[model samples]
Target: MSEQAPLVSVIVPNYNYAASLELCLRALQAQTYAPIELLVVDDHSTDDSVAVARRLGVRVVQTERNMGVAGARNLGVAHAGGEILVFVDSDVAAYPDAVEVAVAMLAADPRLGAVSSIHDPEPLIRDSLVEDYRALQYYYWTASSEGSISFLFPALVAMPRRVYDEIGPFNTQLRETEEVDYGHRLTQRYDMVLTSAVRSRHDHDDRLGKLLRKLYRRGRARVPLYAQRRRFACGFETSSRAGGSLAALAALAALPVAAPLGPAGAMLPAAALAVSIIADLGMYRFVLRRRGPLFLLYFGVVHFVVNVTIAAGVAAGVVRWLFSARFRRLYEPDLHVRPSAAGEAAT
Candidate 1:
């Protein structure tokens, strides 16, 4: 961080996750990069999250009500004074070089709008089943072996002030996928980079219900984006055409197991079930290496349950978005076509 330029502001949004919040703030305070204003938005937490944040001496904004992550992040962005705005989750611990790399990367390229750190997939495996599902999803979204990408998880991403000017703040209505959608808009105008020099530790949820709920919300968020025919960011799981179908098929195949199935009739559905399960397992291994044999077995069961839940939610969201006229129009805001040649979708 150069002394001549404006300072950087790191915004962290927290709910009831007090333990995670403490870890996150501690990591921020210990950053090698110093020109940062740390602001923690307490979204009307019922727990001691506010007290914890206050104890840490970071600027705390207490919301009157519980706004989701997007809302909280927008609030933080509004209060940010830095030339660069970095958004971090309360549950993540930023690597020491987190701020340094982010600032340096963005400063290097005038064309760059945003830069994100590499998140190792260790914390996501603490709870084998749930963590594995979430880890797989996270890896699918953020992992890249090559150069910079346009969109990524906003968990530990940094963007220039110009990004907010050209694009805009996150959509408050979208509790999930707001980062993905916002990143897409930024990428349209400026380059989005992924720096190997930066990193963060993301904590994973071990609970089944929480994982299922998250997947459900993600499914709902994707409705409008996909309906508008937006080019997707992440891989197979995030895409509507591929991951969406997998989710739907997984549910349909499960119906036979719940009810009765004749031996011959059962084979096809049984085979489909096996294939889907195996495919997900393979994806888990390939994208996120199995921690161990025991961890893999437990994670496999959890992954199976999580995917079925996600598939069902995605199917419902897609149907609702496609059928509702208002939703379709809202999502697919019409483009003002210019008189230019080859009037395909505008950049």
Candidate 2:
């Protein structure tokens, strides 16, 4: 409290999240942090996102085309007037003190490059069991890895303007794994941490197909980044977790192949499933403690399906990487400054 608080700019890169934009903006507006400016970069949403932001009386910028989240965020930074930059996704409603706490953490540590917020186990808006499962899974996954992290949770993160200057803007070519590439670039120089002190509630994917597709794309897209690293990041996504998904997937795949062998062949899939479940035993236990036994059963079933989907995605990505030139070049983009995130019609 002794030094003057730097003006903080909160940038929201949105894509058709009108249902929860009000809550996101309201919670952001109520932040205890001082000297903050809010801007929403609508990514050609075919919804009322711009209208919602306008109704809430916040500055709105529309993209010329759907350039992806990274482009939108870059535009927000262009328009932002704060020394501190905060990125809050449209579906996430940050807690009242989220910004204040995050800023303090950034200021307290001169070596810290960025701070990523932890999400509550519950969703911002209760929609379905799938969302609930995602919220809890993400919450536990992140909460278990608080402090000194390599993965950047772009959903709710803060950084000083100087850090942005040094590291440069996000690689716009990285539509799915931009954060992963950015985090890798960032931690090589300065420290980035995932802390519980900065917390928010994210309205995660609520439908099974929608959730699986997103996870699958992210799973496949990240193969190139991991290929470059030759290893997974140091945080939540671990070798053990990847193994669990693979095991679950192998089990699902072995079902028909082993069916001709009768009960003896069933052992392969059953054993694989058991191994997969055991691999992530801690996550299931965390769910059990929080949601009780009944919900835990549902959680297990849903998670098994999710693991299979992730495994499939990674496999697909691997195949593409081997065969397709464009797929392998998913993360190779020039990191130079580009024009406004929006098209000429940007307002």
Candidate 3:
């Protein structure tokens, strides 16, 4: 007889995303991996998400109250029967081979605690300018050299049961940047890989406003995240990106102030801004080469908006963190660990 494959539990935590939930479920059902259990944990979604899960014949675990994504995922882990846990967002549709590839990679390397698929935006990028920018950004970020990765989005990630148990659960208090926190914890013990071999389609918000809001929320969450993991403060994930954006915005803001001084003063800030844009373009040269000059028109505006909004959001988060004792308490790393009883139950 052949050795049995390990059971893989695919957990999807959803809110009011009924429209996209159906497609996400369908993709899970179509996964090539066998002995898979699909579980959808609903966080008191005020939509037809629960009904949709039930109609699809997948087990639905409804939280009594809104526990957010992190809490819902913890609840799912408690109820899971599989030895491997696969977390997929409601807006992501895994390719047929995604689970199989992730599982295979994890199986081949015992040290690999988790593996996240390359999120391809080709499927969702229609004629929308927002979509176009997102697609380009995704391409640039994920096209890095393969090996241990610093970040892993929960949108499509798989990990062994042991890894999750050891690392503990996601920080429920964090409505954003939870994945980064989790990834940081995982890297301390085991390795995480990002491979193009495994693919998934992420349905990003095509609306510019929605995208900016998302970035702002992510930026705000960074305050607490950075507070907990100080080593990551100057790391590529946070400081580099934020610093570059801030620099660009500062130069732009100085342009107006400098204009009143003299033409020479104005030229100084203008030169700085010009240098920043050129550096950004050079950094994303791969994108420019692939998408042609037309991409530059959209990228320039999108880059400015994203950086400016994120910087503002970070500022807001810092003020909130300073004023609210509750926020300060929540930023403590210990608050993120799974409780003893909950961890025991999950095991």
Candidate 4:
């Protein structure tokens, strides 16, 4: 927030997150950055999210239909008048200096197209064990991949309007993997950074089923993009990480098949499991150091299940890619991708 500060519009894309909307906005209200513009773009939420945004004295832009997060964000951008744009999800409570730090990073480096904040290893509100596990897992994944990256975490990220225009709006079709698509497009010419300099606390999935389903869909949805560019958005999504999931999945799939072969076959799955564990042994040790043995044990069990689910999702995506032309063409428009104009998906 230097003198002659440019306007920073913080666009919050919301969908039925009223439970945490107030916290999100209140934190924005207290940002250390000046000349800040905050708007909550509600994507046809059935909950009282709009009311909460209004009560907080923030502008609420309601979408004509359920346009998903990408659409909502595009609409928010359309209404934004700031030189700098910040996208903070409704479920994230950004710290006071989040905007200031992001703006500084962008200003300090002309090559920096986007600066994404890393969330704390805790939720905005303590809800369930699943939430805690997710927060910790996501934090470690991001924290371990700090500095220049190809990934763009939109939950708490900022970029100049010109850079956004150059990269273009997020793909409306990529509701689940828009960030992935955007990151690939952005990284082609500019640098994107993931830093603790701009921090936020996110309200991660509270239910085990919800967490698993989200990851599964994200894993599946990202196949077309990866198939096209084969890009690893960040160091976090490395081959070793994929190997972990695949190894875990191999163990699961081989268990029953190997049961018929008895003792010798059992060794196959055991070795796969060991390889999977070894793949992310650093993550396990990180959790162990922070949460101690008991929580680390629980974290490992949950993470194993998560890895299996992600691998299964990717497997399903591969099968669909081989069979369905449409699935293969999911990111076919990567060369010239843009979001619909502020309101609806292109028809």
Candidate 5:
């Protein structure tokens, strides 16, 4: 604890994640970093999340209605009294050294505005290969020599109190991708660090349906960020390749309507399906190795569905951006700074 800087507040946002939230709370109580206050914000959970927080003796904030993750986090930030704010998901458990490392990283470099800990969790998804691939790709992406991050994950992040002031709070309108939006703004103003030493482990189930939903939301959530011509153009260039493949398949599916090219058009759909299946096999093998055969078969199909749905959503988001000015403006709420102290609370 530094006398110069006020305490660090660790805020965990929860909604019907009682089981996972318990592990997270326990970990916070045992952090190596002292002088920290824990604030658990429950967005009107049906579970006894408030009771659990009370049992732990942490400050509890409750919303009358179910606000999404971003809104809950905003509420927590509003009530936090610490000079440094840390957001840890209810589904994750921070290692004892987690806060210690992040605090040191920010303290040593006055210019570094934010920090995200490495997530080192045991893989639970049935598809081990796909899980490994996702982890590896994320690892490589964040493995910058400068210790600076291009993006922030909501799972675990720490930063100085001044950050929220300059940039803004998590956009209340966003159900997801709020962290990424905030990260872009932070990078523009201050150094955003992805500390390799700080570690946290995510503890939760990633059932096939849940995974698909998450990816679908991710693909959909990226729409607003794509509104800027340069960002949108780059995004479309990549997203189109993924999405166009599926669109091509659907187009080929319509070929049976042509009497002359009936069988040939059918081949197009078959080819598209084959390519997508093979792609998933190769892409997900790294993460799905541990799952049993039955799980693998189901997860493989689920993965494809998720990818296709996300790609489609991205395409839709892009169209909305172009056709609707209101959507484009609202797509990136963090970009449009409104006059409010709530927005000014945490950085």
Candidate 6:
């Protein structure tokens, strides 16, 4: 007699995303992998998300209050009944093979604590410039080398139940970027892989205003995340870009003062700004080639706006971290479970 396949529980945490809930669930139901359980943890959603989950014949766990994504995920894991836990966001549509691929990778390598699918935002990409930019960004991210990753976003991730038990639950206190924190903990002991073999489509925010707001929120989240930790992987790329953008902005701001000094002084700032622009354009040259010159018209403006908003958000986060006791208290000292407790917890 052949052994039965391990159960895989797909946990989805949602809040006010009724429009995409059905599609997300349907995609999971269509997975090639068998012995799967669906758990939808609603975070006090005002919409019809709970009803939709029930109609789909999935288990629905409603939080008493809004606990954010991290909290909702923790609750879902607590109630989950599977040897392998897979997290899928309400706005993500996983490919039929996504779970099978991830599970295979985890089974083949015990050191791999988690695996996340390469998110393709093609479906969400529209004619709008913002949407196009978002799509290209996802494409670039997904194309990255398949190896150990710093973190895995919940959009579509799978890991053995033992990994979760060892790592404990997602920190409920973090309102944003909790995945980064969780990844940091996971990576300390085991590998986290991001593979292009598995795929999923993300219903990304396309509107410029909404996209900017999301960036700002991410920026604000960084403050507390940075405050609590001395260092984090996968931040080098972002920090380098933000640093370059700020340097360019400073050069432009100083242009007026330099103008009063002389041609030489003014030329220095001009040269600095030009270098920044050239670097940015070089970095996004593929985008220009893909979308044509029209993309260039919006590229600079979008880059500047995004960087400025993120800077403002970071500034706000810093202020709050310094003054707000509540913010400081939310930081978790360690996300990893003790070695001695790991064996006990895993069992």
Q: Rate the local accuracy (lDDT) of all candidates.
A: 0.70, 0.89, 0.78, 0.88, 0.67, 0.75
Per-prediction TM-score to the true structure, in the order listed: 0.83, 0.96, 0.89, 0.96, 0.76, 0.85
Q: List the residue pairs that clash in candidate 1.
A: 247-311
Give candidates' CA RMSD values in order.
7.2, 1.7, 3.4, 2.3, 5.2, 5.0
Candidate 6, lDDT over the whole model: 0.75
Please provide, for model 2 over 218-296, each residue's C-alpha lDDT reduced to its tens digit, 9 standing for 90 to 100. Answer: 9999898888679898788989899999999999999999999998999999999999999888889999998899999
Best by lDDT: 2
Looking at candidate 5, the ten consecutive residues that score lowest on lDDT are 338-347
User: For model 2, what is the error of residue 347's alpha carbon versus the real structure, in angstroms, after optimal superposition?
Assistant: 3.8
For residues 1-347, write the lDDT of model 5, one tens digit per residue. Answer: 56564589999988987877878899899987878999998877898877887887877887777778887877888888888899999888888879888888889888888888766525322245445434433443343222655566667888888887678767766666767677777777788766668887665444545655676667666777755634532111243345544654454454565446767656666666666665444434543555456656665554555556767667677777778887667645444354223221222
Winner of 4 and 6 under lDDT: 4
For residue 288, give model 2's deviation from the true position in Å.
Answer: 1.2
lDDT by residue (tens digit), candidate 1, 201-316? 78888777877788777776677776665566643334433453474465567676745666656566566566665555545575445466676677556666666776677678
Reference-based lDDT, residue 127, model 3: 48
Q: Pick the winner on TM-score between candidates 3 and 5.
A: 3
Prediction 2 global C-alpha lDDT: 0.89
181, model 4: CA deviation in Å? 0.6
User: In model 3, where do residues sit more than 4 Å from their true spots?
Assistant: 1-3, 123-127, 233-238, 321-325, 338-347
Writing each residue's lDDT as its tens digit, candidate 3 over 1-347 gives 12599999999989998978999999999998988999998877899998898999988887777887888888888889899999998988899989988998899999999998777747443648787787667655565434567676688899999999999988887778778778888888988887778888877778889989998888877776676556562123545566667767677678778978897787777776665565465546766676777787677778777877877788888898889778767667777785323221211
Q: Which tens-of-lDDT digit does each residue in 167-258 have in candidate 6?
A: 88887666677787788778889988878878988777778899878878877777776667755455223445556555565665777889
> For candidate 6, what is the TM-score?
0.85
**Ranked by lDDT, top first:** 2, 4, 3, 6, 1, 5
